[model samples]
Target: MKKQSYGMKWLSVEVVVILVGLLFLAPFYFVLTNSFKGFAELLVDTSGLPKSLSWDNYARAWEVLNFPRAFLNSLLITLFSALCMVVAASMAAYRLLRHPSRINRVLFSLFVAAMVVPFQAIMIPLVQVGNWLQFLNSIPGIIFCYTGLGVSFSIFLYHGFMKSIPLEVEEAAVMDGCNPYGIFWRIVFPLLKPMTITVIVLQSLWMWNDFLLPLLVLQKPELQTIQLATNTLFGQYLKQWDLALAALVMGIVPILTFFLVLQKHVIQGITAGAVKG
Candidate 1:
């Protein structure tokens, strides 16, 4: 009777979880289904599926948004920023570990503190600095901004994960005549793979989806990221709902596909990162 009772409890939990999952997925269903609909049909019944599957909205959005260019811009910015953040954060974290100092403590504390300080607090000053540095309206400009914004949290994650790494392995590598650089790249970095993947996934998502920073930095339409391009569909008076929805669906598909592909790695990375922190 106890065994049967446990089985029934587990089944109930599973059913509840399935229902919640469907509930969360409901918005995605509406967006996807309505993306195929005309403005009129969508207004009539958004909850219902499209009367007829049509790619008209998608085609219009694609042309107006200049999806190809925006996609390339977003991809470049995300990949570059993610790569830089991973390398710089991992190295900074490792160095702090290797050479523990009062300064290192202060630095780590600053990084941690920065995580709590909202971006809005610093955005105005950041923009001023960017302008002074001549980093405005350029890909390199926004990439630099992303690096600064992402690096703090990345360092925190890497630092925590670094704590779980056995120091003796690095010591062994050093004793074998490996220089500091070689010791880090060859021995230590490979071990940081899980956390590194986590950082990459996180930074990529942030940079790819980020609109505000890119908007402030890259003002030119030619250099617009996907988010910026999508925002153009929203006029002051009349919003293009069909085009906007289609663009949203388009934007969502790429990241969703990316996450699905690397979801296992992401899960493993998060688990491994949490184990140390």
Candidate 2:
């Protein structure tokens, strides 16, 4: 009787887990299915499967959104932003960990505290500052903002992972006459892969899907990222559901592929803090 009860409890838990997962995936199903339907069909039957799948919407949206240009813009922004955060955070965290001076400690605390400061609180000031610095309305400008916003959390993650790496590794490098730059670039930085991949994946997803920041920083249609290009489908009066959904699906695919490829490293990153090098 006890064993049977335990088996039933486990089965119940599995059922609940599957249900919750499907609940989360419901939006994806809606978006994908609706993307295949005509705009009228979508409005008529949102819950039902499309009568037939058609690539017509994809074709139209691709040209309308200028997927190639928007994709290139998004790719550049995400790539550069992620790289800047990884490099800056990794180096800063290494300094904080290895040096442990009073000022460094205080700076580390400030970084942690900054993580809790909502972007909304600084949005207006950020715009003013960016304008003053001539850092608005360009891809590089947005990358700069993303780096500043992302650095705090990235440093925190690197700080944890850096703890797993032994100090003796750097000591040996020092004895071998490896300069500080060489020690960091060659020895320490390679050991940071798991967390590095994690930061890249997380930040890439955010910058790729993010609409608001790009909308603010990139006003020129020529500078539009995929999210902003997709937004063009919605006007003051009419929202082109078919084209919009298709563009959304197109926008989702590349980043989805990126995450799937690097997901193992993401898992490793999550567990890195518990295990030592």
Candidate 3:
């Protein structure tokens, strides 16, 4: 009797958790299904699946949004920015960990402190600086901005895990006549793979999905990121629900595919960091 009761309780809990997950996923389902429906059908029944599959909405949205260009722009920006941030941050973290000087300590603290500073507070000043630097509407400019903003948190995560790496390994490499750069590149960097993967995955997602920064930085229609392109589907008086939804689906696909593929590494990276620390 007690075994049966416990099984029932477990089943109930599982069902509840499933229901919660469904609740969170409901919006995505609505967007995906409605994207295939006609305007009239969408208005009549937002929740139900479309009576007939229609590819026109996606086709029209792709052309109107210039999705191919937007996708490429987003891909380039995100990939470059994330790569720069991970490499720079990892090197910085490694140096800070190995050196451990007062100045490095102060800088590390500042990086941690900067994480708490809201972007809104400094957005105006950042924009002004970008304008002064002629980075106002350039991809490289946007990449530089993302690299700077991402460094603090990335450094923090890298720094924490770097301490777990044994100093003996670096010292042995040094004794073998390896320079600092050589030692870091060959020995330390390989040890940092897990944290590096973590940083790459997390930062890539942020850069790929980022809307506001790209919107402010890239003015040319040809340079707009996927998020910016998707926003163009909605106007002041008229919102193309079908097109908007289609664009949204397109925007999410790449990141979703990336995450699905690297999910194992991502989880392993995170767990390794936790265990090592």
lDDT (10s digit) by residue, model 2, range 99-157: 88999999999999999999889988999899998989988999999999999999999
What range of 10 consecutive residues in model 2 has the weakest lDDT sum? Answer: 268-277
Question: Per-residue lDDT for 7-86 in model 1, tens only?
Answer: 99999999999999999999999889989999999899989988899999999999999999999999999999999898
Which residue pairs show backbone clashes in model 1?
none
| Model 1: residue 60 alpha-carbon error in angstroms | 1.3
Top-lDDT structure, candidate number: 2
TM-score of each: 0.96, 0.97, 0.94
lDDT of 3: 0.89
lDDT of each: 0.89, 0.93, 0.89
Please tell me which model should have the higher TM-score, number 2 or number 3.
2
Question: How many clashing residue pairs appear in each of the predictions shown?
Answer: 0, 0, 0
Error of 3 at 221 (Å): 1.2
